[model samples]
Target: MAKVKSLDDLKKIKEEFLSKEELQKNGDKSLGIVQIKVAMATCGIASGAKKTMDYLINELDNRAIDAVVTQTGCMGYCYAEPTIEVTLPGKEPVVFGYVDEKRAGDIIEKYIQGGELVGDVIPVNYETIEEHNIE
Candidate 1:
Protein backbone atom coordinates (compact mmCIF):
# COMPACT_ATOMS: atom_id res chain seq x y z
CA MET A 1 0.00 0.00 0.00
CA ALA A 2 1.11 3.55 -0.65
CA LYS A 3 1.84 5.86 2.24
CA VAL A 4 -0.83 8.48 2.92
CA LYS A 5 0.70 11.94 2.60
CA SER A 6 -2.31 14.06 3.39
CA LEU A 7 -5.71 13.95 5.14
CA ASP A 8 -7.46 13.49 1.79
CA ASP A 9 -5.19 10.59 1.01
CA LEU A 10 -5.84 9.11 4.42
CA LYS A 11 -9.59 9.45 3.94
CA LYS A 12 -9.32 7.74 0.57
CA ILE A 13 -7.38 4.92 2.15
CA LYS A 14 -9.94 4.56 4.87
CA GLU A 15 -12.79 4.45 2.40
CA GLU A 16 -11.02 1.87 0.30
CA PHE A 17 -10.32 -0.27 3.32
CA LEU A 18 -13.93 -0.02 4.45
CA SER A 19 -15.18 -0.96 1.02
CA LYS A 20 -12.91 -3.99 0.96
CA GLU A 21 -14.06 -4.97 4.40
CA GLU A 22 -17.67 -4.62 3.29
CA LEU A 23 -16.91 -6.84 0.33
CA GLN A 24 -15.42 -9.51 2.56
CA LYS A 25 -18.33 -9.25 4.97
CA ASN A 26 -20.75 -9.56 2.00
CA GLY A 27 -22.37 -6.20 2.67
CA ASP A 28 -25.52 -5.75 4.77
CA LYS A 29 -28.39 -7.98 3.74
CA SER A 30 -30.80 -6.19 6.04
CA LEU A 31 -30.65 -3.19 3.70
CA GLY A 32 -32.62 -5.28 1.15
CA ILE A 33 -31.00 -3.50 -1.78
CA VAL A 34 -29.59 -4.83 -5.01
CA GLN A 35 -26.52 -6.95 -4.39
CA ILE A 36 -23.83 -7.39 -7.06
CA LYS A 37 -21.05 -9.94 -6.66
CA VAL A 38 -18.24 -9.62 -9.15
CA ALA A 39 -15.94 -12.60 -9.74
CA MET A 40 -12.47 -11.43 -8.76
CA ALA A 41 -10.43 -14.59 -8.97
CA THR A 42 -7.22 -14.77 -11.02
CA CYS A 43 -8.98 -15.48 -14.27
CA GLY A 44 -11.54 -12.81 -13.55
CA ILE A 45 -8.88 -10.15 -13.05
CA ALA A 46 -7.19 -11.20 -16.27
CA SER A 47 -10.52 -10.78 -18.04
CA GLY A 48 -11.10 -7.23 -16.70
CA ALA A 49 -13.41 -7.95 -13.81
CA LYS A 50 -11.69 -5.22 -11.84
CA LYS A 51 -12.67 -2.61 -14.42
CA THR A 52 -16.20 -3.92 -14.47
CA MET A 53 -16.35 -3.77 -10.68
CA ASP A 54 -15.05 -0.20 -10.55
CA TYR A 55 -17.47 0.85 -13.24
CA LEU A 56 -20.36 -0.76 -11.39
CA ILE A 57 -19.44 0.93 -8.15
CA ASN A 58 -19.04 4.38 -9.67
CA GLU A 59 -22.09 4.13 -11.91
CA LEU A 60 -24.31 2.83 -9.16
CA ASP A 61 -23.31 5.69 -6.90
CA ASN A 62 -23.61 8.25 -9.69
CA ARG A 63 -27.06 7.01 -10.61
CA ALA A 64 -28.08 7.09 -6.98
CA ILE A 65 -29.11 3.46 -7.14
CA ASP A 66 -29.37 1.47 -3.96
CA ALA A 67 -26.97 -1.35 -4.63
CA VAL A 68 -24.22 -3.22 -2.84
CA VAL A 69 -21.30 -4.18 -5.05
CA THR A 70 -18.77 -6.67 -3.73
CA GLN A 71 -15.87 -8.72 -4.99
CA THR A 72 -16.05 -12.51 -4.77
CA GLY A 73 -13.96 -15.50 -5.70
CA CYS A 74 -14.35 -17.64 -8.80
CA MET A 75 -17.87 -18.52 -9.81
CA GLY A 76 -16.52 -21.59 -11.66
CA TYR A 77 -16.93 -19.88 -15.02
CA CYS A 78 -13.47 -19.31 -16.32
CA TYR A 79 -14.79 -19.13 -19.87
CA ALA A 80 -16.86 -16.21 -18.61
CA GLU A 81 -14.14 -14.68 -16.58
CA PRO A 82 -15.62 -11.22 -16.08
CA THR A 83 -18.86 -12.51 -14.67
CA ILE A 84 -21.13 -10.99 -12.06
CA GLU A 85 -24.03 -12.25 -10.01
CA VAL A 86 -26.79 -9.76 -9.32
CA THR A 87 -29.46 -10.34 -6.71
CA LEU A 88 -32.42 -8.03 -6.39
CA PRO A 89 -34.34 -8.02 -3.21
CA GLY A 90 -37.12 -10.66 -3.21
CA LYS A 91 -35.77 -12.15 -6.44
CA GLU A 92 -33.44 -14.91 -7.52
CA PRO A 93 -29.83 -14.12 -8.25
CA VAL A 94 -28.86 -13.89 -11.92
CA VAL A 95 -25.35 -14.44 -13.15
CA PHE A 96 -24.19 -12.55 -16.23
CA GLY A 97 -21.06 -13.37 -18.20
CA TYR A 98 -18.53 -11.43 -20.27
CA VAL A 99 -19.38 -8.32 -18.35
CA ASP A 100 -17.33 -5.43 -19.69
CA GLU A 101 -18.07 -1.83 -18.79
CA LYS A 102 -20.72 -1.31 -21.47
CA ARG A 103 -22.46 -4.58 -20.70
CA ALA A 104 -22.32 -3.65 -17.04
CA GLY A 105 -24.00 -0.35 -17.80
CA ASP A 106 -26.74 -2.15 -19.68
CA ILE A 107 -27.18 -4.53 -16.77
CA ILE A 108 -27.56 -1.60 -14.42
CA GLU A 109 -30.11 0.20 -16.59
CA LYS A 110 -32.14 -2.73 -17.89
CA TYR A 111 -31.93 -5.45 -15.30
CA ILE A 112 -31.20 -3.66 -12.06
CA GLN A 113 -33.28 -0.59 -12.62
CA GLY A 114 -35.99 -1.75 -14.99
CA GLY A 115 -36.28 -5.34 -13.81
CA GLU A 116 -35.79 -6.60 -17.35
CA LEU A 117 -33.45 -9.45 -18.19
CA VAL A 118 -30.54 -8.67 -20.51
CA GLY A 119 -28.31 -10.85 -22.63
CA ASP A 120 -25.27 -12.96 -21.69
CA VAL A 121 -27.09 -14.65 -18.87
CA ILE A 122 -25.38 -17.79 -17.63
CA PRO A 123 -28.02 -20.13 -16.36
CA VAL A 124 -27.76 -21.57 -12.87
CA ASN A 125 -27.17 -25.25 -13.48
CA TYR A 126 -26.63 -26.48 -9.95
CA GLU A 127 -29.00 -26.52 -7.01
CA THR A 128 -28.05 -24.60 -3.91
CA ILE A 129 -27.94 -26.31 -0.51
CA GLU A 130 -30.97 -24.34 0.59
CA GLU A 131 -32.91 -25.37 -2.49
CA HIS A 132 -31.95 -29.00 -1.99
CA ASN A 133 -32.97 -28.89 1.63
CA ILE A 134 -36.30 -27.28 0.74
CA GLU A 135 -36.99 -30.04 -1.71
Candidate 2:
Protein backbone atom coordinates (compact mmCIF):
# COMPACT_ATOMS: atom_id res chain seq x y z
CA MET A 1 0.00 0.00 0.00
CA ALA A 2 1.29 3.43 -0.90
CA LYS A 3 1.54 6.09 1.74
CA VAL A 4 -0.99 8.91 1.54
CA LYS A 5 1.40 11.88 1.45
CA SER A 6 -0.87 14.48 -0.10
CA LEU A 7 -4.45 15.69 0.02
CA ASP A 8 -4.92 14.86 -3.65
CA ASP A 9 -4.02 11.22 -3.09
CA LEU A 10 -6.35 10.99 -0.12
CA LYS A 11 -9.20 12.52 -2.08
CA LYS A 12 -8.65 10.06 -4.93
CA ILE A 13 -8.81 7.14 -2.58
CA LYS A 14 -11.89 8.54 -0.89
CA GLU A 15 -13.62 8.96 -4.22
CA GLU A 16 -12.96 5.39 -5.22
CA PHE A 17 -14.16 4.03 -1.88
CA LEU A 18 -17.22 6.26 -1.89
CA SER A 19 -18.23 5.05 -5.33
CA LYS A 20 -18.17 1.46 -4.17
CA GLU A 21 -20.16 2.33 -1.06
CA GLU A 22 -22.75 4.13 -3.17
CA LEU A 23 -23.15 1.14 -5.41
CA GLN A 24 -23.68 -1.13 -2.42
CA LYS A 25 -26.24 1.23 -0.95
CA ASN A 26 -28.05 1.45 -4.28
CA GLY A 27 -28.35 -2.31 -4.48
CA ASP A 28 -32.12 -2.50 -4.46
CA LYS A 29 -34.94 -3.44 -6.78
CA SER A 30 -35.93 0.17 -7.27
CA LEU A 31 -32.43 0.87 -8.56
CA GLY A 32 -32.33 -2.27 -10.68
CA ILE A 33 -29.35 -3.50 -8.72
CA VAL A 34 -28.17 -6.96 -7.85
CA GLN A 35 -28.36 -8.19 -4.27
CA ILE A 36 -26.00 -10.87 -2.97
CA LYS A 37 -26.42 -12.66 0.33
CA VAL A 38 -23.57 -14.69 1.76
CA ALA A 39 -24.24 -17.23 4.46
CA MET A 40 -22.01 -16.55 7.45
CA ALA A 41 -23.17 -19.15 9.88
CA THR A 42 -20.70 -21.36 11.72
CA CYS A 43 -21.09 -24.10 9.14
CA GLY A 44 -20.58 -21.64 6.37
CA ILE A 45 -17.49 -20.15 7.97
CA ALA A 46 -16.05 -23.58 8.56
CA SER A 47 -16.52 -24.16 4.85
CA GLY A 48 -14.84 -20.90 3.83
CA ALA A 49 -17.74 -18.54 3.32
CA LYS A 50 -15.69 -15.53 4.42
CA LYS A 51 -13.22 -15.92 1.60
CA THR A 52 -16.00 -16.37 -0.87
CA MET A 53 -17.69 -13.23 0.39
CA ASP A 54 -14.52 -11.19 0.16
CA TYR A 55 -13.89 -12.36 -3.37
CA LEU A 56 -17.38 -11.40 -4.44
CA ILE A 57 -17.13 -7.93 -2.90
CA ASN A 58 -13.81 -7.13 -4.53
CA GLU A 59 -14.70 -8.63 -7.87
CA LEU A 60 -18.05 -6.88 -8.01
CA ASP A 61 -16.44 -3.53 -7.30
CA ASN A 62 -13.69 -4.12 -9.84
CA ARG A 63 -16.28 -4.92 -12.45
CA ALA A 64 -18.16 -1.73 -11.54
CA ILE A 65 -21.34 -3.70 -11.05
CA ASP A 66 -24.09 -2.10 -9.02
CA ALA A 67 -24.64 -4.63 -6.27
CA VAL A 68 -25.01 -5.14 -2.54
CA VAL A 69 -23.03 -7.90 -0.83
CA THR A 70 -24.43 -8.67 2.60
CA GLN A 71 -23.59 -11.31 5.19
CA THR A 72 -26.40 -13.46 6.47
CA GLY A 73 -27.01 -16.18 9.05
CA CYS A 74 -27.68 -19.87 8.41
CA MET A 75 -29.70 -20.49 5.26
CA GLY A 76 -30.61 -24.04 6.36
CA TYR A 77 -28.31 -25.56 3.77
CA CYS A 78 -25.66 -26.86 6.10
CA TYR A 79 -25.09 -29.85 3.88
CA ALA A 80 -23.85 -27.47 1.25
CA GLU A 81 -22.11 -24.72 3.15
CA PRO A 82 -20.78 -21.47 1.72
CA THR A 83 -24.02 -20.73 0.00
CA ILE A 84 -24.90 -17.47 -1.71
CA GLU A 85 -28.20 -16.10 -2.91
CA VAL A 86 -28.18 -13.69 -5.81
CA THR A 87 -31.29 -11.66 -6.50
CA LEU A 88 -31.37 -9.67 -9.68
CA PRO A 89 -33.86 -6.95 -10.26
CA GLY A 90 -37.42 -8.22 -10.81
CA LYS A 91 -36.24 -11.84 -10.57
CA GLU A 92 -36.51 -14.58 -8.03
CA PRO A 93 -33.39 -15.22 -5.98
CA VAL A 94 -31.11 -18.08 -6.99
CA VAL A 95 -29.07 -19.83 -4.33
CA PHE A 96 -25.74 -21.44 -5.13
CA GLY A 97 -23.80 -23.74 -2.85
CA TYR A 98 -20.20 -24.89 -2.36
CA VAL A 99 -18.95 -21.59 -3.66
CA ASP A 100 -15.24 -20.94 -3.44
CA GLU A 101 -13.39 -18.00 -4.90
CA LYS A 102 -13.36 -19.46 -8.40
CA ARG A 103 -17.05 -20.25 -8.35
CA ALA A 104 -17.80 -16.79 -7.03
CA GLY A 105 -15.85 -15.23 -9.89
CA ASP A 106 -17.70 -17.35 -12.42
CA ILE A 107 -21.02 -16.26 -10.91
CA ILE A 108 -20.07 -12.61 -11.16
CA GLU A 109 -18.88 -12.90 -14.73
CA LYS A 110 -21.54 -15.14 -16.20
CA TYR A 111 -24.67 -14.63 -14.15
CA ILE A 112 -24.37 -11.08 -12.88
CA GLN A 113 -22.57 -9.46 -15.78
CA GLY A 114 -23.69 -11.50 -18.76
CA GLY A 115 -27.16 -12.31 -17.40
CA GLU A 116 -26.60 -16.03 -17.98
CA LEU A 117 -27.27 -18.81 -15.52
CA VAL A 118 -24.34 -20.67 -14.06
CA GLY A 119 -24.09 -24.22 -12.81
CA ASP A 120 -23.93 -25.31 -9.12
CA VAL A 121 -27.22 -23.79 -8.09
CA ILE A 122 -28.90 -25.34 -5.07
CA PRO A 123 -32.49 -26.28 -5.71
CA VAL A 124 -35.11 -24.50 -3.64
CA ASN A 125 -37.81 -27.06 -3.00
CA TYR A 126 -39.97 -25.41 -0.40
CA GLU A 127 -42.14 -22.33 -0.70
CA THR A 128 -43.68 -19.81 1.67
CA ILE A 129 -47.39 -19.40 2.39
CA GLU A 130 -47.53 -16.45 0.06
CA GLU A 131 -46.70 -18.71 -2.83
CA HIS A 132 -49.73 -20.89 -1.95
CA ASN A 133 -52.03 -17.85 -1.74
CA ILE A 134 -52.77 -18.55 1.91
CA GLU A 135 -53.04 -15.44 4.06
Candidate 3:
Protein backbone atom coordinates (compact mmCIF):
# COMPACT_ATOMS: atom_id res chain seq x y z
CA MET A 1 0.00 0.00 0.00
CA ALA A 2 1.26 3.42 -0.85
CA LYS A 3 1.51 6.18 1.72
CA VAL A 4 -1.54 8.44 1.80
CA LYS A 5 -0.64 11.81 0.35
CA SER A 6 -3.85 13.63 1.24
CA LEU A 7 -7.36 13.22 2.61
CA ASP A 8 -8.60 12.17 -0.81
CA ASP A 9 -6.09 9.37 -0.91
CA LEU A 10 -7.10 8.19 2.54
CA LYS A 11 -10.76 8.29 1.58
CA LYS A 12 -10.04 6.26 -1.54
CA ILE A 13 -8.21 3.68 0.52
CA LYS A 14 -11.06 3.48 3.00
CA GLU A 15 -13.53 3.04 0.19
CA GLU A 16 -11.49 0.23 -1.24
CA PHE A 17 -11.34 -1.51 2.11
CA LEU A 18 -15.08 -1.16 2.66
CA SER A 19 -16.16 -2.04 -0.88
CA LYS A 20 -17.72 -5.29 0.29
CA GLU A 21 -19.68 -3.54 3.03
CA GLU A 22 -20.81 -1.00 0.49
CA LEU A 23 -22.15 -3.76 -1.73
CA GLN A 24 -24.10 -5.26 1.17
CA LYS A 25 -25.37 -1.89 2.30
CA ASN A 26 -26.60 -0.94 -1.12
CA GLY A 27 -28.35 -4.33 -1.53
CA ASP A 28 -26.63 -4.66 -4.90
CA LYS A 29 -27.50 -8.26 -5.61
CA SER A 30 -25.34 -9.82 -2.88
CA LEU A 31 -28.19 -9.94 -0.43
CA GLY A 32 -29.76 -13.03 1.11
CA ILE A 33 -26.38 -14.43 1.97
CA VAL A 34 -24.42 -14.38 5.24
CA GLN A 35 -23.32 -11.41 7.31
CA ILE A 36 -20.21 -11.82 9.43
CA LYS A 37 -19.07 -9.37 12.07
CA VAL A 38 -15.83 -9.88 13.96
CA ALA A 39 -15.30 -8.28 17.35
CA MET A 40 -12.30 -5.97 16.93
CA ALA A 41 -12.14 -4.05 20.13
CA THR A 42 -8.87 -3.76 22.10
CA CYS A 43 -9.56 -6.92 24.04
CA GLY A 44 -10.45 -8.77 20.89
CA ILE A 45 -7.23 -7.70 19.16
CA ALA A 46 -5.24 -8.80 22.18
CA SER A 47 -6.84 -12.21 21.85
CA GLY A 48 -6.03 -12.58 18.12
CA ALA A 49 -9.28 -11.47 16.56
CA LYS A 50 -7.38 -9.99 13.64
CA LYS A 51 -6.05 -13.36 12.59
CA THR A 52 -9.44 -14.96 12.94
CA MET A 53 -10.95 -12.19 10.88
CA ASP A 54 -8.38 -12.56 8.13
CA TYR A 55 -8.88 -16.30 8.08
CA LEU A 56 -12.61 -15.96 7.72
CA ILE A 57 -12.38 -13.36 4.97
CA ASN A 58 -9.90 -15.38 2.94
CA GLU A 59 -11.61 -18.70 3.47
CA LEU A 60 -15.00 -17.34 2.61
CA ASP A 61 -13.66 -15.77 -0.54
CA ASN A 62 -11.77 -18.90 -1.52
CA ARG A 63 -14.89 -20.99 -1.00
CA ALA A 64 -16.95 -18.58 -3.12
CA ILE A 65 -19.32 -17.75 -0.27
CA ASP A 66 -21.37 -14.63 -0.73
CA ALA A 67 -20.89 -12.86 2.56
CA VAL A 68 -19.92 -9.49 3.91
CA VAL A 69 -17.27 -9.42 6.62
CA THR A 70 -17.19 -6.42 8.92
CA GLN A 71 -15.47 -5.40 12.13
CA THR A 72 -17.35 -4.25 15.21
CA GLY A 73 -16.64 -3.02 18.70
CA CYS A 74 -16.70 -4.95 21.94
CA MET A 75 -19.59 -7.37 22.40
CA GLY A 76 -19.21 -7.30 26.24
CA TYR A 77 -18.14 -10.91 26.34
CA CYS A 78 -14.58 -10.22 27.35
CA TYR A 79 -14.09 -13.79 28.49
CA ALA A 80 -14.91 -14.85 24.98
CA GLU A 81 -12.40 -12.35 23.54
CA PRO A 82 -12.13 -13.26 19.88
CA THR A 83 -15.73 -13.71 18.87
CA ILE A 84 -17.79 -13.50 15.71
CA GLU A 85 -21.44 -13.00 14.91
CA VAL A 86 -22.82 -14.71 11.83
CA THR A 87 -26.26 -13.92 10.54
CA LEU A 88 -27.68 -15.98 7.74
CA PRO A 89 -30.37 -14.46 5.63
CA GLY A 90 -33.84 -14.66 7.19
CA LYS A 91 -32.38 -16.27 10.29
CA GLU A 92 -31.38 -15.07 13.73
CA PRO A 93 -27.74 -14.25 14.24
CA VAL A 94 -25.41 -16.54 16.20
CA VAL A 95 -22.26 -15.59 18.07
CA PHE A 96 -19.31 -17.88 18.53
CA GLY A 97 -16.38 -17.55 20.92
CA TYR A 98 -12.67 -18.36 20.96
CA VAL A 99 -12.47 -18.12 17.21
CA ASP A 100 -9.02 -19.33 16.35
CA GLU A 101 -7.92 -20.28 12.82
CA LYS A 102 -9.12 -23.89 12.99
CA ARG A 103 -12.42 -22.91 14.56
CA ALA A 104 -12.88 -20.26 11.90
CA GLY A 105 -12.36 -22.85 9.17
CA ASP A 106 -14.81 -25.17 10.85
CA ILE A 107 -17.34 -22.37 11.06
CA ILE A 108 -16.98 -21.66 7.36
CA GLU A 109 -17.02 -25.27 6.23
CA LYS A 110 -19.88 -26.35 8.53
CA TYR A 111 -22.04 -23.52 9.73
CA ILE A 112 -21.69 -21.23 6.77
CA GLN A 113 -21.57 -23.83 4.03
CA GLY A 114 -23.42 -26.83 5.41
CA GLY A 115 -25.98 -24.95 7.55
CA GLU A 116 -24.96 -26.84 10.67
CA LEU A 117 -23.75 -25.43 13.96
CA VAL A 118 -20.19 -26.53 14.72
CA GLY A 119 -18.57 -24.21 17.23
CA ASP A 120 -18.76 -22.76 20.73
CA VAL A 121 -21.90 -20.71 20.38
CA ILE A 122 -22.61 -17.88 22.77
CA PRO A 123 -26.26 -18.08 23.53
CA VAL A 124 -28.40 -14.99 23.25
CA ASN A 125 -30.25 -14.49 26.52
CA TYR A 126 -31.69 -11.04 25.90
CA GLU A 127 -33.70 -9.40 23.20
CA THR A 128 -32.67 -6.27 21.43
CA ILE A 129 -34.81 -3.15 21.17
CA GLU A 130 -35.37 -4.03 17.56
CA GLU A 131 -36.61 -7.51 18.43
CA HIS A 132 -39.37 -6.36 20.82
CA ASN A 133 -41.07 -3.33 22.21
CA ILE A 134 -39.90 -2.00 25.55
CA GLU A 135 -42.04 -0.04 27.96
Candidate 4:
Protein backbone atom coordinates (compact mmCIF):
# COMPACT_ATOMS: atom_id res chain seq x y z
CA MET A 1 0.00 0.00 0.00
CA ALA A 2 1.15 3.51 -0.77
CA LYS A 3 0.67 6.71 1.20
CA VAL A 4 -2.35 8.84 0.46
CA LYS A 5 -1.17 11.81 -1.59
CA SER A 6 -4.33 13.86 -1.94
CA LEU A 7 -8.03 14.02 -1.26
CA ASP A 8 -8.80 12.00 -4.39
CA ASP A 9 -6.36 9.34 -3.26
CA LEU A 10 -7.91 9.26 0.18
CA LYS A 11 -11.37 8.85 -1.27
CA LYS A 12 -10.21 6.04 -3.51
CA ILE A 13 -8.48 4.27 -0.61
CA LYS A 14 -11.60 4.55 1.50
CA GLU A 15 -13.80 3.23 -1.25
CA GLU A 16 -11.51 0.27 -1.72
CA PHE A 17 -11.45 -0.41 1.99
CA LEU A 18 -15.24 -0.29 2.19
CA SER A 19 -15.58 -2.59 -0.78
CA LYS A 20 -13.25 -5.11 0.81
CA GLU A 21 -15.01 -4.95 4.13
CA GLU A 22 -18.43 -5.37 2.55
CA LEU A 23 -17.47 -8.77 1.25
CA GLN A 24 -17.57 -10.23 4.76
CA LYS A 25 -20.92 -8.65 5.63
CA ASN A 26 -23.34 -11.52 5.03
CA GLY A 27 -26.53 -10.25 6.63
CA ASP A 28 -27.29 -8.10 3.68
CA LYS A 29 -31.02 -7.48 3.18
CA SER A 30 -31.94 -9.37 6.30
CA LEU A 31 -35.25 -8.26 7.71
CA GLY A 32 -35.87 -7.30 11.34
CA ILE A 33 -32.50 -5.70 11.75
CA VAL A 34 -31.52 -3.76 14.85
CA GLN A 35 -30.56 -0.11 15.12
CA ILE A 36 -27.31 1.08 16.72
CA LYS A 37 -26.59 4.20 18.73
CA VAL A 38 -23.14 5.48 19.64
CA ALA A 39 -22.66 8.20 22.21
CA MET A 40 -20.97 11.18 20.59
CA ALA A 41 -20.67 13.51 23.54
CA THR A 42 -17.59 15.62 24.26
CA CYS A 43 -16.27 12.95 26.55
CA GLY A 44 -16.97 10.24 24.00
CA ILE A 45 -15.12 12.10 21.27
CA ALA A 46 -12.11 12.60 23.51
CA SER A 47 -12.11 8.86 24.20
CA GLY A 48 -11.94 7.91 20.49
CA ALA A 49 -15.69 7.36 20.14
CA LYS A 50 -15.78 9.04 16.76
CA LYS A 51 -13.56 6.42 15.16
CA THR A 52 -15.58 3.60 16.66
CA MET A 53 -18.80 5.19 15.49
CA ASP A 54 -17.48 5.61 11.98
CA TYR A 55 -16.22 2.05 11.94
CA LEU A 56 -19.64 0.81 13.02
CA ILE A 57 -21.40 2.79 10.29
CA ASN A 58 -19.07 1.44 7.67
CA GLU A 59 -19.41 -2.10 8.96
CA LEU A 60 -23.18 -1.83 8.99
CA ASP A 61 -23.28 -0.44 5.49
CA ASN A 62 -20.87 -3.08 4.26
CA ARG A 63 -23.03 -5.83 5.69
CA ALA A 64 -25.97 -4.20 3.91
CA ILE A 65 -28.08 -4.48 7.02
CA ASP A 66 -30.70 -1.75 6.97
CA ALA A 67 -29.81 -0.30 10.33
CA VAL A 68 -30.06 3.24 11.62
CA VAL A 69 -26.78 4.43 13.16
CA THR A 70 -27.02 7.63 15.09
CA GLN A 71 -25.45 9.44 18.03
CA THR A 72 -26.72 10.40 21.45
CA GLY A 73 -25.79 12.82 24.21
CA CYS A 74 -24.05 11.84 27.44
CA MET A 75 -25.51 8.70 28.98
CA GLY A 76 -23.49 9.13 32.18
CA TYR A 77 -21.13 6.42 31.01
CA CYS A 78 -18.10 8.58 30.43
CA TYR A 79 -15.85 6.05 32.06
CA ALA A 80 -17.00 3.59 29.36
CA GLU A 81 -16.21 5.58 26.29
CA PRO A 82 -17.34 4.50 22.85
CA THR A 83 -20.53 3.19 24.30
CA ILE A 84 -23.30 1.91 22.04
CA GLU A 85 -26.96 0.98 22.26
CA VAL A 86 -28.45 -1.76 20.15
CA THR A 87 -32.20 -1.64 19.69
CA LEU A 88 -33.87 -4.71 18.36
CA PRO A 89 -37.24 -4.18 16.77
CA GLY A 90 -39.39 -5.87 19.40
CA LYS A 91 -37.18 -5.35 22.43
CA GLU A 92 -35.83 -2.39 24.34
CA PRO A 93 -32.40 -1.09 23.50
CA VAL A 94 -29.41 -2.69 25.21
CA VAL A 95 -26.45 -0.46 25.96
CA PHE A 96 -22.91 -1.76 25.56
CA GLY A 97 -19.90 0.01 26.97
CA TYR A 98 -16.21 0.19 26.10
CA VAL A 99 -17.06 -0.95 22.64
CA ASP A 100 -14.34 -1.70 20.11
CA GLU A 101 -14.14 -3.70 16.91
CA LYS A 102 -14.31 -6.98 18.79
CA ARG A 103 -17.34 -5.96 20.85
CA ALA A 104 -19.03 -4.58 17.79
CA GLY A 105 -18.56 -7.87 16.02
CA ASP A 106 -19.83 -9.73 19.02
CA ILE A 107 -22.82 -7.42 19.11
CA ILE A 108 -23.62 -8.04 15.49
CA GLU A 109 -23.23 -11.78 15.90
CA LYS A 110 -24.48 -12.56 19.39
CA TYR A 111 -26.90 -9.83 20.41
CA ILE A 112 -28.27 -9.00 17.00
CA GLN A 113 -28.29 -12.50 15.69
CA GLY A 114 -28.93 -14.52 18.83
CA GLY A 115 -31.15 -12.02 20.63
CA GLU A 116 -29.05 -12.46 23.76
CA LEU A 117 -27.58 -9.87 26.09
CA VAL A 118 -23.90 -9.01 25.94
CA GLY A 119 -21.49 -8.52 28.84
CA ASP A 120 -21.91 -4.83 29.65
CA VAL A 121 -25.24 -3.05 29.75
CA ILE A 122 -26.44 0.47 30.51
CA PRO A 123 -30.01 0.48 31.67
CA VAL A 124 -32.48 2.83 30.07
CA ASN A 125 -34.01 5.21 32.59
CA TYR A 126 -36.48 8.04 32.43
CA GLU A 127 -36.27 11.21 34.45
CA THR A 128 -39.52 10.44 36.17
CA ILE A 129 -42.08 7.66 36.34
CA GLU A 130 -45.80 8.22 36.44
CA GLU A 131 -47.91 6.41 38.96
CA HIS A 132 -50.27 4.17 37.03
CA ASN A 133 -51.33 1.95 39.91
CA ILE A 134 -54.61 3.75 40.46
CA GLU A 135 -57.23 1.36 41.87
lDDT of each: 0.88, 0.87, 0.87, 0.76
**Which model scores highest in lDDT?**
1
lDDT of 2 by residue, 6-125 (tens): 999999999999887555444464577788999998989999999999999999999888787999999999887889999887677899988999989999999987789886889888
Regions of model 1 farther than 4 Å from truth: 1-31, 130-135
Root mean square deviation (Cα) for candidate 2: 10.5
Residue-level lDDT of model 1, residues 57-118, one tens digit each, is 99999999888798999999998769999988667789999999999999999998899999
lDDT (C-alpha) at residue 32 in model 2: 72
lDDT of 4 by residue, 48-115 (tens): 77887888888878877667788988778887887998877656668899887778877877787777
In model 3, the clashing pairs are none
> Could you list the CA RMSD of all candidates, in the order they appear?
9.1, 10.5, 6.5, 12.4
Q: Give me the runs in candidate 2 sitting further than 4 Å from their true place.
A: 1-30, 132-135
Cα error of candidate 3 at position 113, Å: 0.4
Tens-place lDDT per residue, model 3, 17-63, is 68755455455334766899999999999999999999998999998
TM-score of 3: 0.73
Backbone clashes, each candidate: 0, 0, 0, 0
Q: State which candidate, 2 or 3, has the greater TM-score.
A: 3
Candidate 2 lDDT at 92 equals 75
